[model samples]
Target: MAEVRGRDTWTEELASLIEDSGVRYGGDSPPTSFEVHAPQSESGESLKEQALGFVMAWCEILMELGRGFRDILRQNLINEDSYVVRKFGGPCSKVSKRLRFLNDFLPEDRDPFHAWSVVFFVFILALAAISVDPNREAVAPVVKVRQHPPSASRVLLPDGRYMAYHEQGVLADTARFSLVAPHSFLSSRLAGLPGVKASLLEEYGIRLVTYDLPGFGESDPHPNRNLNSSAMDVLHLVNAVNVTDKFWILCHSSGCIHAWASLRYIPEKIAGAAMLAPMINPYDPHMTKEEMKRTWEKWLPRRKMMYSLARRFPKLLSFFYRKSFLPEQHDEIDKLLSVSPGKKDKLVTEEPEFEEFWQRDVEESVRQGNIRPFIEEAVLQVSNWGFDIKELHVQKKCQTRGILLWLKSMYSQAGCELAGFLGLKHIWQGLDDRVVPPSMMEYIERVLPEAVIHKLPNEGHFSYFYLCDQCHRQIFTTLFGTPQGPVERQEETATAFEEEDKEEVLQVPV
Candidate 1:
């Protein structure tokens, strides 16, 4: 006679179920229990109860095996579609076919344990075969990820060219006006500095507008654009945006040329102008020996070399630019941010704000794969500027009172007066600048002797960006009154001004 076990005995029997199932599906087998039990009774009731317990434990084992097979099949499918699988023929497809065949053979009947076991065994053999295949290679799945959108907008000009621009500050009737001409290799977005933005709105109630020159940023390439034509484009931009009031022009480095052109072509439209570490026209015959020496030896040797190359072989220079600076590799930007020997250069590199601004400026400048505008601007800088700086003399008999009244109307103030002379020019230069040598100041002084000049002996060419707050204070104070009251905090937004009615007549300065 044999003894019959209770439900508690089934718990001990099910202990090996999980471990043995793992072994069958490619894991190590667990130790077997050595406890011996008395034989079960031969009566039908006892035998049926034993069979039912064994079937319940077998069902649990099948579930574990099913999970393992599902994971393996998923991995196989991913590998089958991978690059390595496409490049080198592999056994991934064969393994998948075997898995499908095994799944198809699985019975949907009352007792599925034996049939599932056969499928599990076949799966193990298939995996082993795949591992031993000579041409097989491990491959991972490919995933697609999206990138963030750009922070700038493009405006299609009347000439079918696109201009990229950024705007900040409040738009109102009394808003002061500023048109920023950024330095070489800098897009208009460079004007999006926190300090500059704060100072413009808080100090003077001004709106700061900056845009990329043709061939830079998203602006289309205007291969034949001269300094004067570029000024016309800016004027076109001003009218397109409905800026009826006279606006101040601010420039840095080589941007002075554009500012100077604006003053010459549209003198009546300008309230005042300021230039920082401004570059003098290199082609000017009156450039002193000292100026030429500093420009060639100290200030812009690399630019001179590149300009020479660009003038002779533009396409070659374009190829070099694309390979070097066009991509988002950050090599050129890193160089700009790295420590430099010059005081101003080092200052700009160390200042985190300027570093961030410069990096974004360079990136946006080449956003559209148009390095041609930069190259063209470079070539133009070293070449004739198509105008004489001496010919830009102030007209003494001009209606200064009428201009003052117009300014008052724009500012919505009764007695707002011009801070300095009607056509005042301010030139701010850093003595320690290596990019645009301080010697260039002598040329400017010689030509515009009456112009107000601020010489910072310890600063560098990038002093404008590093010392933006101080520069803004000096510039705004000279143009308007001193900044007062609490700093106005406003969210900076971008605006795109499109070309309006073609028949709208534009006033041209005679």
Candidate 2:
């Protein structure tokens, strides 16, 4: 029974299995005992003993699994009383009692039971206890799981100080959803050199501070955590790194969402922001689902199938998924998934830590006993929350596109709305073939005409990693004349990611 529960991901199915198993065992126990007194053939006696042994073994395994599960839950800080104690009581009690009963059966004097059963019983119980309280503070080692081939040729920077370096957008680590490493390239061979360090100190005089978004990299996973809150966490990290001065911001693809959103809310603290293949929505917020369907209809034929397969076989297809990002279109998907206006390129695949995050989510939902439809509803809620933010404050009837437009207007107007507000001297690089359509960039250019747009021909989405040297040169030029500003520090008060610079604008009547 414990094995049955542990094997299934859903709570309902596991609960049902436990229920049925308990009922069968409960009803059959007396009959089985009565049959033990049969004066039948020796074969019948042997069969009865075998059946009893099977029942006992099954019960023992169930008890161990239950114990192990309980340990995992408690260690993970999941309150088991929320679900098991209140909702699923019978099974839990049965498992505990059976294990206790089995303890007495372990003695050699009692029917000469097998020594292995006793050994396993002791091992499982001990393991359950150990696993339940296994150091709550344990941190997983960071590993690089993927990198681009050409990026393998670039020299890697040292790890001691905060230095700026680019990652060749390969899914290298399984730590978080979309953790772009500081200087991890495709090649382990090139990482030995202090190339990234030299570039940061010499070329830009900037220190490198790396971070993992909530569901990615070195950060803890919060499956139900809101995106706005998660984005704020990135800003909080800036203070934690002791960088007390305004720093240049650069982001690729989906990362641009948080980067841009940060700049929008806290424009004064940002010296400049450079978005490579940044994700921005061109659609209006009010567009209907049908309209979105119509807009995506062209890609729907392929995208739906891809989404289905990716969901079904996440582990097997993760490699191919990374490969799909072209050299020039690294930031393309970020823009595509940016359902929020100005938040394009938001790809779900960037979150390698999703599984760990979801494990916590599952544990919590199970504990709450609101497991069955909650998982399905949670996915939709995640989608809608991000989508709704993009269309905030639109009085017009909401269409899918209109909704996004309304959100864009509200979000953009709230920030620095001055003429030179977005004057970052940005050198934008975009690939036409990537997930973000060329049209999205054109739209942003229309709004912020001052941004310098550089289109990389013949490259797909992720080509920026290969063009690091050129990007570095452009950034170096921008940093040389711009005097370094004093770092603005903030208190580590709330996990709330408040913008460092929150300037209020006074609107005057004409």
Candidate 3:
């Protein structure tokens, strides 16, 4: 009784104080007091109380429903003049008046439609529980990466950024031909044509140059990089590396976007393009019905969704990329890329050598551990490339599009000129590739009819490109006719001196 009186006194004092304050301020009177009642279970826990309430509420409702069902069942079994019995059941009963149902089996207790509906609902609920990712609502990662220094051979670009690069085969001056190979997504300069031996390159006299994309590997990040900037970067790289003559652009998978950009912006600098399992824009407007169907059907639904997200809502890409690749513990390549690999691709990925190389290459790729560069790369793959593949086809174009240009073209030789890239394009497509479907190759062939397509049977996206020396040799032979060996760089100064001093040579011999 004393404790209750003390509590009541405290409540009264609080109420009086609140009333006095409200009156002093000339405001509306506040609530004198409020009670916070925490409904508790028998065990004195609120959560258990909530669970009990929830179960009881559902049970109460279901019990009523169950009663109604029971009444209906009883009517159907006992009442002969029920609505359903008088309708369809009458004729059946009349025809089977003399017949009897087997009592061994339970009477029809379950309605087929209702039972199936319950099963379907349960199935959908289970799928919803599985498919609905909670991370979709998540914004950031828990574990963040700290800054780390570069770990690759670097070059200074015009943009004042260091580009990481790797040189294979012969020296630049001794190179008969230069091949600039840009790596695919989640790869670095270290990924330059895996399993391609130095002897093979020397035999062909080809200088194979591979470089990291901006912000990838040990390279400095570009603030506002795009396709045009990508082409400019490659141009600067080749010039920096002393590639004076036009060079071939080699590509694999998504890396072909850079090659396409080079062909569009700096066609004069590019001699040819060799693409293996090249990726095309999924949202390209020029795709025909059959092409779109065949191309889209080859990919899993998740990949299509990812493409749509990258193309339409690129801002959302950071979230997904952060979840997959930005962290130290990342998803598998297929899961990260949302690719459904075919059998050959699975075999290639499962190889011990492929795993080792892929792990190292991926580490080098995400060395900087910055997500913006990856976001930029993903956006570049699906967004407008500023030029179409058909534009690379050799064709004549006027300085202007109208009749003034045409009228001038009839008189002036400079009014019109050959506009498109005149170089040959060699595309090697794996027929069983799931990442980049063969239909994309078909589309490329359709647009640029001059591009020759070589089909690889039973090969996958990675099988032919990853670590197959035979495939590499075949690709080399197809692009470059025969192994010509390294260039015999005749020393111009030495030759000139020898020619001018033949008398000295003759006197010394005597």
Candidate 4:
């Protein structure tokens, strides 16, 4: 009996507290009473029952508070003179009309208990509708790890910059020679074809190394890096890898300038060099009639515009680069997929394998953030290279048995069986290439007269990927004695446009 009396007393006090709270929140309401009855049990009402009675009274207080907040909000919405209501006229008017309808439905003359009961029932229904299942397991957020290709690896330069590189072919061969390839703008080392590993191992036995230039891909950006400084970084990379034997250099498009710089700076270290559709010094006086005509009409004007933009309106150029070149953006991908094929489709837009490769390469190029290095590389290409092209022309004569012939023969008998293949430089260019005009080939020819010229009549800037098998066969045949086997080819289906190669529509940076 004493326990029952105590529970009743607690319940009465809880009801009184709730009634006072409701009147305080609801504003100028008549006196109201909340009678909370404690459940009777034969074992007597436990503490749990008393606690539940208090919780019920507290819920009633909360419902009254919610009603007060809603009424306040409705009053604010109905105020026509208020700035908030005037500014949001349509929304405020709708809210005011709904509130008025609710008020009319529950008039001031209506019983207070009946009106509060309706509000409490509505609140309970809303709570039930939105309630979450307590038994449900919460899904953990997925943590994504950015994955690079198998060929990708990072090295720390002496200057503390992290340099990303791709190494392909055999690394364990006793007579292995390193072939360093520098990628062009908006391209990664994955752009180069190192041939099938089995064939490279059995025939040439070479490890092809390619890296992201400063400001592109994973390499740290050097805002002030010039062509010569980039060459120096490459040399440091070579030394970091601890390659004692003379290495070969292969470059494409704008990368040719760096190759030339390497040949000048580290002449003794370079065995041989090759440039495919190599970008030439535009100011070279030895340009052919056709080259001069293209330069004057097409190339020069385009370069002048780009240079001016990069120099004066860099922010504008940066904005363009982000919108146009970023692979993560669907705009670039959509543009590529929608472009119509013509003679301009020199790249592997029609080929699935090459397109996939090129897409991944572009994606990785800007993954680190900032396209400034790529832009700087472009500007450096059109501007002065800080070294004369004539310096690369000074060839060291090979001595019999005394001095090692770095570039004398394509294959070397002493260090590598493929060392003799080192000195013979090749510069392959396409007449139809719009990215770097065929006229640029004339400038390369003038500077490096000894460089064997392969002029493709039908191909354009990116035709090498389409004719990748042929290129491999040609390269092997030139270096090694004969072609090993039939090269694997990408599917010949027009999947997307080689939008990157469309220099006229989309400006080629270098």
Per-residue lDDT over 1-510 for candidate 2, one digit per residue giving the tens place of the 0 to 100 score: 665554443544644775533322223122243222334585588799999999999999999999999898786544655565566667767756644544553655654245656677997897578557655224433222232222211111121222122332212221111212111111111221113334343323344344433322222334454545534554555544434556566565544555555555555556666666665432434444554444344343344444433334334334333443222122222322222222111222243443233222222212222222222222322143353223211123332256766677665654323333343636455443344545555555655566677776654444443324555555445545542321221123222254322222234334
Highest TM-score, which number?
A: 3
Provide the overall lDDT of each model, using Cα atoms, as 2-decimal numbers.
0.63, 0.41, 0.82, 0.64
Per-model TM-score versus the true fold: 0.57, 0.37, 0.68, 0.55
TM-score, prediction 4:
0.55
List runs of model 3 lying over 4 Å from the truth. 1-150, 398-416, 489-510
Best by the lDDT measure: 3
Q: Total clashing residue pairs per candidate? A: 0, 70, 0, 10
Model 3: how large is the Cα RMSD against the reference?
20.9
Worst 10-residue lDDT window for candidate 1 reads 489-498
Query: Runs in model 4 with CA error above 4 Å?
Result: 1-151, 172-175, 194-198, 283-290, 296-304, 311-315, 330-347, 395-423, 480-510
How many clashing pairs does model 2 include?
A: 70
lDDT of 1 by residue, 1-510 (tens): 122243334434665664333222212223353443334453567779899999999999999999999887668744768666676555756645544543554556624557677767997898589558765322312211222246655676778887777766546344655554544544545544335755456456776777778877656788589988888888877776667878878777777778888888878788878778777666578877777776667634346646566555565567556655654445433232221337666656667676566556666666666667766776677777777776664423322378766665665645543322357788888888777777788777777777888888787766664547776666777767765422232212111122232223344334
Instruction: Tell me how far the alpha carbon of residue 367 in candidate 4 is from the true structure, in angstroms, after superposition.
Output: 0.3
Q: Given candidate 2, what's the lDDT at residue 336? A: 25
lDDT of 2: 0.41
Q: How many backbone clashes does candidate 3 have?
A: 0
- The TM-score obtained by model 3 is 0.68
Return whichever of 2 and 3 wins on lDDT.
3
